[model samples]
Each structure stands twice: as structure tokens, then as C-alpha cells.
Target: MNLLHAYVSGRVQGVYFRGWTRGHAQRLGLHGWVRNLRDGRVEVLASGPDNALRELQELLYEGPALSRVDGVEIVAMADEEQPTHGFSIAPTV
Candidate 1:
């Protein structure tokens, strides 16, 4: 398994980014959550098979049709920090 912690920047807020992230995460059988940051970025944390996580990372770059994703900064997380189950869209923080 692999865990990914990412911050997606650029025109990501107010564009259904969280919703689209949750949907894609769930479809990929990833566990964790996505939320909007006060700094106009979108934050995502997901854990799953390495292949699945890689696929999801690709999708994050494109996001929804309305979003203009400038960049995605991703980091690998230790297994202890990875969420165990389910994907969700979290409240803005």
C-alpha cells in the first residue's frame, strides 16, 4: 500500500474540486479525505495500492472541467499515518 498527501494549488477552490476528488478516490478504492484550505488550495490525503494511488495522482492534475489546476505537490506518507478506510469530502479548513 501507499499513502499520498498532496496540496493542489491554483484555481482549485469553488470549482467542485473536493467533490471530484472524493468521487475519484472512492472509485479507486482509496481511503482518506479531501478538503479546501483557507489559503485557496485543496488538500488531499489518500491511501491505497501503489498503482491506484498513482492513477489518482494523475487525475488530481486534471481535476474537474471548471478547475484550473496549476500544480499538485505530493508527498509519500508512512503507513502509520495513512487512513484505513473510506473516502470523503471534508469541510473547509
Candidate 2:
């Protein structure tokens, strides 16, 4: 299993990025959450098979066609400890 945390920048807010991310993550059978950061970025944490996680990250770049994703910063999350079950959209932070 693999877990990843991704922060998507550039016009990510107010564009359904979080919702879209949740759908994609769910489709990929990933667990974790997505939320809007105060700094106007979409923050997502996804855990699943390595291949699925990679596919989900790639999908984030397009982002429901309404988003203008300029950059994506990803890092491995090793402290989660426990596995996630399903994807969700979290309240803005």
C-alpha cells in the first residue's frame, strides 16, 4: 500500500476541486480526504495501492475541467499509521 498527500495550486478554490477529487479518489478506491486550504489550494490525502494512487494524482491535474491547475506538490505521508477506508471531502481549513 501507498499513501500520498498532494497540494494542488492555482485556481483550485471555488471550482469544485474538492468534490471532483473525492469522486476520483473514491473511484480509485482510495481512502483519505480533500479540503480547501485557506491559502487557496486544494489539499488531498489519499491512500491505496501504489498504482491507484499514482493514477489519482494524475487525474488531479485536470480537475473536473473547471479548474486551472497550475502546479501540484506531492509528498509521501508516513505518519498516518492506520489505513484509510474511503475518500471524503472535508470542510475548508
Candidate 3:
């Protein structure tokens, strides 16, 4: 198992990015959260198989149709990030 932490920027906010992310993550059998950042970015944290994590990163780059993803900055998370059971939309931070 692995975790994926990504900060997606550029036209990411105000779109259905979080919803889309949650849907995809669930379909990929990942457990995670997606939220909007105050700085016009979307933050996603997912835990699943390594391949699923990588796939989520790619999907982050190609967000919802209304989104124009300019960049996705990936970060490594500590094992303690804590994996929950299901994907959901986290409150914006």
C-alpha cells in the first residue's frame, strides 16, 4: 500500500474537481480525501496500491472538464498520515 499527496494548481478550484477526484478514487478502491485550498489549489490525499496512487496523480493532472490543471505538485507523506476507509470531500483549508 502507498499514499499520494498532491497539490494541484491552475483552474482547479471552482470546478467539480473534488467530486471528480472522489469518484475516481473510490473506483480505484482508494481511501483518501480531496479538498480545495485557500490558494486556488486542490489538495488530494489518497492511500491505496502504488499503481493506484500513480494513477490518481495522472488524473489530478487531467482534472474535470471545467478545470485547466497547470501543475500538480506531489509530496511524500509519512506512514502516519493515517488511511481512512473511504474517499470523501474534506473541508477546504
Model 3 worst lDDT window (10 residues): 75-84
Q: Which residue pairs come into collision in candidate 2?
A: none
lDDT score, candidate 2 = 0.85
User: What is candidate 1's lDDT per residue for 12-62, written digit by digit as tens?
Assistant: 998899999999999999999999999999999999999999999999999
lDDT of 2 by residue, 1-93 (tens): 778888999998888888888888888888889999999988888888889988998988888777899999997667655356777888888
Each candidate: what lDDT?
0.92, 0.85, 0.91
Give, for candidate 2, the lowest lDDT window spanning 10 residues.
76-85
Best prediction by lDDT: 1
Better of 1 and 2 by lDDT: 1
List candidate 3 stretches off by more than 4 Å: none
Q: What order do you get sorting by TM-score, best first?
A: 3, 1, 2
Count of clashes, each model: 0, 0, 0
Better of 2 and 3 by lDDT: 3
Model 2 compared with the native: what TM-score? Answer: 0.91
Residues 21-45, candidate 3: write the lDDT tens digits. 9999999999989999999899999
Most accurate candidate by TM-score: 3
